[model samples]
Structures are given as structure tokens and as C-alpha cells.
Target: MHDPFVPHEMADEAGVHPVTLADLVAQSDIILPHAPATSDAPLMDAGCLATLKRGAVLINAARGALVDGRLPGAGLDVFRQEPPDPSNPLLGMANVFLSDRTAWYP
Candidate 1:
């Protein structure tokens, strides 16, 4: 619950205690990165992923991720490399789910 756009008062009223981004990711069972990503840094990297609680799930709304190693499960809507290479480990994980950013035709 760390949205800078979210007024402190609104968050408090909703019983959401906004915490430091690192702390939120480290503590949450389910993490949803609620911000947009920049070209300078990925929303989540291997280092950040390593800090997460074991068995934690990462849900990437649109932010890209560069991850290597294990995850209990991951739901990613974006990747550091679109249509990631066949050798990418995340692609081989049974617990990881990935989707394209594009909307489907009717």
C-alpha cells in the first residue's frame, strides 16, 4: 500500500498503512506494483525479488521484471524483455503465469 498519489488521509481512512516500497515488498504475501516503470530501473529485479518473503507472490500490473531463480508463483503482465526468450527461466516455471499487454479483438 505505497501509492504516493494516494493521500495519506485517504489511505488512513481505508485502514491501509502505507509503508516504504522495500518494506511492503518484503512483508506482503501478495505484492502488486501499483506504479508505472521507468527505463532506468526495472520495477523488480533479482535483488528485489531476493528480498521478498519466501512463497510470496508477485503480481506485476505493467512494470517489467528481470528475475532469475525461484518464486512460489508470479503473475506478470510485463517483462523486461517482451515475448521473453525460450530459455528464460520464468517461462519454464509451473507456478509462473504471463500475459501480453495488448487487448484481444472482439
Candidate 2:
């Protein structure tokens, strides 16, 4: 319900209420990044993570680079690097839930 590229008509047809990305992040209790990744920028970087409501959780079924590892908590199914290095900070965070990238496979 929060895609900038979705046409207004399409959104209306699908009964999706459109909202700005910033507004969605600030208000959502669980943020899901389903958009394609961009090489130049991450969809949810440090600043975006900071705006999340207290104790909010981020769910990234998309590319891992979409999120900054400094978030309060998250459920990640993908990583910027496949088989994230052992030294990755996110691996040590108890608040994070990591899954193999194949999480979406049937």
C-alpha cells in the first residue's frame, strides 16, 4: 500500500491506500521491504531505521542491503552478501532473526 511507482488508478483498483515511504516507515509497526534493490541507495538505511516507532520490527524479504544493521530489531531473509561474514554485526545481535535467503521459496 506504499509504493511510489504504483499508478493511482492501479492503487484504487486494488483497494490499496497509498502513503509516502517516510510516512509508512514512521507509522508502521512492521516494515517490509518488497521493492527491488537500487545500486545507488538502500531503501531503508540508518536514517529510515531511526524513524521507526519504538520496538518496531523490520522484515526484509528483499535484498539485505535495503536495511542498515544498526536497527533495533529485524527479521532478515536476505543479505547484501550471501552467507554473511561471521564478523557481521547483525549476526551477534540478539534482537535480529536471520533466515536463509531461500525463505520465500515454496
Candidate 3:
């Protein structure tokens, strides 16, 4: 898992927190953690989604593939597909916060 989303300066330009995704989910209003590469179900992704307090927002400003694609919840922003499959469950969620694929680009 990547480090917690600490400020770059506190991270000393390369400072990585010793925290896991579970730690961040347990500590913040917004949960931003990476998905494991080899898991078909993306356990961390599912766990974080489940761990989120009800009505919480999930912001995926990175890759959409990290999302489990089959979980249920909201406040989710996923752009793995330019326009995700119409049947994608994430689109139907009310608490989700979706953005076009390019929203995060500079």
C-alpha cells in the first residue's frame, strides 16, 4: 500500500507514512488509497468502501481500475473508462461524486 496522503513537505519530498489503506480509512473524511495489483476483487478497495461511514465520499482521482467494479457505495469518482459501461453500478449510486476522465489532468 502507498503512504497516507501526508503533505509532500512533511513527507520530506519522499516521506512515506508507515500507514496502510486501513489506517487512512480509519482516520479521514476522504479515503484515498491504492488498490492491490494482483487481486481480482481488490480487497483493500472493498474493505475501504465498506469501512467508510455511511454518506461518506470516495474520491478516486487516480485510476478507475482500482475500484472493485462490483462493490456498492457512494462518493465515488472513477474514470477507468472514458465513459464507463452504461450498466456500471457506480453510476447509479446517489452518494458518488463522479468526474470526467480528464478532470484530474494538469
* Local error of candidate 1 at residue 90 (angstroms): 4.7
Runs with alpha carbons beyond 4 Å of true place in candidate 3: 1-17, 34-43, 53-56, 69-77, 102-106
What lDDT score goes with residue 35 in model 3? 48
State, as a TM-score between 0 and 1, how close model 1 is to the true structure. 0.62
- lDDT of each prediction vs. the true structure? 0.71, 0.79, 0.58
lDDT tens per residue, model 3, 19-106: 5666666666765645434444553555566666655555565566666633344454555565788887667777565766565699
Report how far off residue 96 is in candidate 2 (Å): 3.0
Higher-scoring candidate on lDDT, 1 or 3: 1
Q: Once all C-alphas are superposed, what RMSD does model 3 give against the true structure?
A: 5.6
1 or 3, which is superior by TM-score?
1
Give the TM-score ranking, best first: 2, 1, 3
Runs of candidate 1 with Cα error greater than 4 angstroms are 5-10, 65-75, 85-97, 100-106
lDDT of 2 by residue, 11-42 (tens): 99998889888889999987777877777578
Count residue pairs with overlapping backbones in model 3.
4
The numbered model that scores best in lDDT is 2
